[model samples]
Target: MSTVKRWTVDVLVNDDEGRTYAEACLHSGEADTRLVGIGRAKLNPADRDIPEIGDELAAARALCDLGQRLLVEAANDIEAVTHEPVRLRR
Candidate 1:
């Protein structure tokens, strides 16, 4: 037998003044857990005014941080079951 699970990640991006901020939220139905990650991108003085680029960068960084947090959470769960320290790698 096999089991199938569903997970969802929502990313919201906002731009203010020359800076972009992103928040990534992860929802796991199986675990009933929620995790959030935040990221920001600042426009360099010499850079051009491209809002899309900043949004992309900020969202990517936020997702990356969310992934790391998920890994750590998984490691903690495993350690709890095994009674030993565990490290998870991407």
Candidate 2:
């Protein structure tokens, strides 16, 4: 039998001073797991003041971190069941 599952990810971005911060949170109902990823982008003194660019960069980094975390979690779970070391590719 096949089962259907739903997962959601929430991303929040904030800009303060010359820096931007982003946090990505993942909600997995079936596994009852919550994962969080954080990212930050800094504006250089010579760089232009573009809020959108910072937001995009920070959010992208956060999502990348979240993806890596999820992979690690999955690898751990697989190892737990297999009783051996497991390596997951990105």
Candidate 3:
């Protein structure tokens, strides 16, 4: 028999600059792909096929990567303002 699973995904950020962001998500109607499954808080890849965890973490990773790029861009801006070397070594 086939099985359907549910998952919850959450994102959180709390910075020292008095800023906070948080989100929670529930995903349903998800089928066992013979490639993936669901845990209490994450959608994980199936053990026989993929065996990794965290769609949520994967999304967070992409966001963090973009954030790092933006941070470097901001630093480059500051360097331009101060005539400093923009060593953007991404």
lDDT, each prediction: 0.94, 0.95, 0.42
Ranking by TM-score: 2, 1, 3
Worst 10 residues of 1 by lDDT: 80-89
Error of 1 at 85 (Å): 0.8
* TM-score attained by model 2: 0.94
RMSD of each: 1.1, 1.0, 19.1
Highest TM-score model number: 2
lDDT of 2 by residue, 1-90 (tens): 998899999999999998999999999997879999999999999988999999999999999999999999999999999999998878
Q: Candidate 3 on 1-86: residue-level lDDT in tens?
A: 99656644344432222222323332323532111211222332343322133334444554555456556766877897999877
> Of the pair 1 and 3, which is ahead by TM-score?
1
- Report lDDT (Cα) of residue 65, candidate 3: 54
lDDT of 1 by residue, 1-90 (tens): 999999999999999999999999999997789999888999998999999999999999999999999899999989999999997769
Which residue pairs overlap in candidate 2's backbone? none
TM-score per candidate: 0.93, 0.94, 0.36
lDDT of 3: 0.42
- Quote model 3's TM-score: 0.36
Runs in model 3 deviating more than 4 A are 1-54, 86-90
